[model samples]
Target: MFGLQACAKAPTAAADAAKPAAAAQDDGGYPLVTDVRLQNAGNDDGWLMYRRDYGSSGYAPFDTVNAGNVAQLKQAWDYTSEFDMGHEAPPVVNGDYMFITTPKNHLLAFQASTGKLLWKYEHDLSNAGLKTVCCDVVNRGVALYQDKVYMATLDNHVVALDAKTGKVAWNEKIHEQDVGYAMTLAPLVVKGKVIVGVSGGEYGARGYVTALDAATGKEAWKQHTIPMPDEPGGDTWPKGAAETGGGAAWLTGSYDAETDTLFWGVGNPGPWLATLRPGDNLYTDSVIAMDPATGKIKWHYQYTPNDTWDYDGTNETVFTDIDYKGAKHKAIVSASRNGWFYAIDRTDGKLIYAEKFATATSVTGPDANGKMQTDPALRPTVDKEVFTCPSFLGGKNWWPISVSPQTGLAYVPTLHSCMTIKGAEVSYKAGLPFLGESFLVKRDPAFPNQWGSVQAIDVNTGKQAWTFPSELPWNSGMLSTAGGLLFSGSADGYLYAFDAKTGKVLWKSPQMTSGVLGVPSTWKVGGKQYVGVWAGWGGASPIWGGEMAQDPKVKGIPLGGHLYVFSL
Candidate 1:
């Protein structure tokens, strides 16, 4: 049996936003992205942030080119990252300049209209940094604010660089690089705060989210995921392991400007076993709403308590307003790694409803709060191996799901995979991927021939609308336009558009040399609308490339590193 731990004190807020004095930096507050971050303010440009906005809907309201002329979209230009790995960064376009980050942490500013390299910034990441990265070695993307671009390095340092000159400005060490912690998600800027989360929950590091003074590089606040004795969540952890309890806050978060709340998704608990440290871990594998001004958690809902299958709830918690039972309510939706689609009241973190979108047997019914009811038998034992429906990689990984408010549904690229899990005694050693033992298993048994799929789900009804199977698993992030069409890339190097109502493939073209893995973006440039995506194959699939390599369909497809922009 797992030992229930004591909780820690609720993490404290560091900065006082009520101070009327001017910031120490030259500017009173952080500058806004005049040409980029707010580009969609009717100027007709490109996507600025991961998930398009703080909402993480991956939906752009622009619909200049709809289903009729989408077929005419041809390649506008292609820019190569040259470093390869996985080109997962989405390009942010301002006027004519497009900013992108490579997997190796090289920041580049390119000509959006013509594929011309303007400037590239490369950080001297320590060799030690390379060794501690637990997953794919790459940076997800960058955040553009004021006239500077902010990026968190694999070495756990958040560095601010001149957006135009590509020159380093102020740099601060956010976390120790030797602790197996890193940053891969794009930094989110809310009001004047630059918010970022740590990665390495799988590697046994404490998970937390930090807010920094965007202009002065001053520490604003820090919120720990797990709790220690005397803390609000201290009672949720084992007696003494709360400090080391893993609850990594990865991926970007959602912002509710009306309520001044920031909603971020938290990753799995440490050690990969419930028996190691028991009790419902406070914030692990949960969606938490925090006060951006003070970093105090307003409310939280744990998606998977004492998670043993590694089903992280750290995907985008997309903000959307829906009519429930005839009344309109603000809501946030997430397709968690636990293989369930959930809708919650964004205002107070109350469970509205949840349904399994995949073949999940770990949970039977909904808890009183509407969360999936977990089967106690699914929890791993010291000497027993348990096979779960969706493996540690999750039914849905980091791929951003596209939500069409027009159709009131979300289109997701779901993975039909499972991991054969077995827990072992593990010890946390700084600077190494923490875990005692590993497992080897097949992903999908029923449809071994199919690994990936694009499924349309009705957010209002909690039912799958349509399913479009992919030859390979883990396609790419999705982008939906007002054109009544959904755009996404596949591991087969094909960029496709499917009818939003019905899962029908309307058009597809070979845009990348290898399988595509990054999210897709659409924008209007030169009076013509264009769709864009980074083409590179890297992620957990490639990390377990040996298992994926056996699939004949994705067998010969090489990895690619380039950005393809299409316009009609």
Candidate 2:
């Protein structure tokens, strides 16, 4: 077993005074991140959000570190955080400062070029019920706007910090921490509002997305992921199940500037066994399109209605234009947890194409209207066990997929595993897990010796273009570049750069201290381009997927919190 490193001490006043005067001058006069700024973020100098842009393109336009010269890449700098738990937050880069959050809600800022500690803000959450968090204690990342950096905390609060200094400008509580409500998703700044979602789907917490005033920490609007009795799609839920019906919007969502709509994916329903909740359970496993200004649902598409297999639709949704049926269509594509890759019309929430991205035996395919045609025999029952493909983690999870306009393919980080699920009786408790099912996950025999894959799918045809396999389940999110490089980290601790056109591995780094689970980001500072990713491993996989986590294939991987930056 790997030992945990001692936490790094916070910089003292004397160390701050000894810094060079030019450190402050490094601010590059970055403009306020508005809708226009987010739309053009691919060409921007810094990584601004979770997926680096509002459309969630995850493509960096910088070309200084191309495939030809990527072999010469070296570690420019690294920062080890204090916490040893999951360090999944993608470093948010602005002008000169880069911001990141770690376990226990510790936020740190560093010099973008030198990795110098700027400041740290440790939030006090003594009253929070940390045990209620279903997965490992983790924060996805942060959002940046005018001069304030927005982050959702694990204790159900949204905080705005001064980007220059790590001081809190305002803090507002969004939900009660002890009631199975927490925030793990990065707050997204959409049209001057900080939009965030809640976690605790396992605890039967009713999920919702709330928009807070960016300038002030006041609530602007709130939209429940589960519908009320009088609302649309309400009849899908049982008489009173909507009160605790889980539809957590826990992953960062994407935006469409052209339509002024926000596309957010919803998670699974509570009491994991569908037999307990009954009905279709509206909005739980669905993608909702809402007006960013008013938080009104324009339309929604449910990926897994009556989801019995614990398939959550909280994966990131990528918005792009694709040629569908010999015509160009604005599409929202998702590698769904139910093992299907779907391309829906972003303008009207109509399915343009749907196909399997992973092995899923429970469903034959989509029906004429795109609803999943679930195999009733494969559904779990109270008295018997049912085998299902893709496990509960789905074909993918919160780890993001990148849609590269350069290659016209969506690079998906996928897992090839299945589960045997058995249902049981479960009672709802405020701060306890409401899961009514037990599952054991294992790698599918068809994919022997391979549990992870980075698949490049052609968006136009909804087919796999190429695939790169890994021995362990891939946990890292993807970052694509115009320089013909696709970057993804692995559970084995190596950050790999693959040729975007083909799945050939161009360059890979020596194994680091821990596995790489965080998303990768790229930015340019001082005329030099750098790629950065967090190296730490601990998420839902280790906590929930027992067999896969303890598999001898990945026993060599370690757990530690370190940010690695590489440059050519």
Which candidate comes out best when scored by TM-score?
2
Q: Which stretches of candidate 2 lie over 4 Å from their true place?
A: 1-35
Report model 1's TM-score to 2 decimal places: 0.91
Clashing residue pairs in candidate 2 are none
Worst ten in a row by lDDT for model 2: 14-23
Q: Per-residue lDDT tens digits of candidate 1, residues 1-568? A: 1111122123243211111122122242222364234433222355667777777888877777677777777777776557657777777765455678888678887656565666788877856546767667777787767667888878887888876567888888888775768888889887667889999886788899999988877889999887777889889887767766778887989887778799999988887777887788888889999999878988898888777777787999987887767767788989988888888999988888788887776756576756556888876776878777776666788888988888898988898877677778788776666565466546668657677799998888668999999768865888887888899888878789888888788888654576788888876545556677887877777676346556666666676587787777
Q: Give the per-residue lDDT digits (tens) of candidate 2, residues 1-568.
A: 3333333334333212112222222243434555566666666787878898888888888789998999998887788877667778887886557888888888888877777787888889887769887788899889988778888988899999887777789999988787888888898888889999999888899999999999999999999999978999888888889998999889989888888899999999997889887788879889999999888999998888899888899888898899977999999899988889999999999889888999988867778867767888988888989878989988988889999898999999999999999988889989988989988998787798888899999999999999998888998999999889999998878889999999899998767778888888998776688888888988888777768888975766777888888887
Q: Could you list the CA RMSD of all candidates, in the order they appear?
A: 9.6, 3.5
Which regions of candidate 1 fall more than 4 Å away from where they truly are? 1-44
What local lDDT does model 1 show for residue 245?
Answer: 74
TM-score of each: 0.91, 0.95
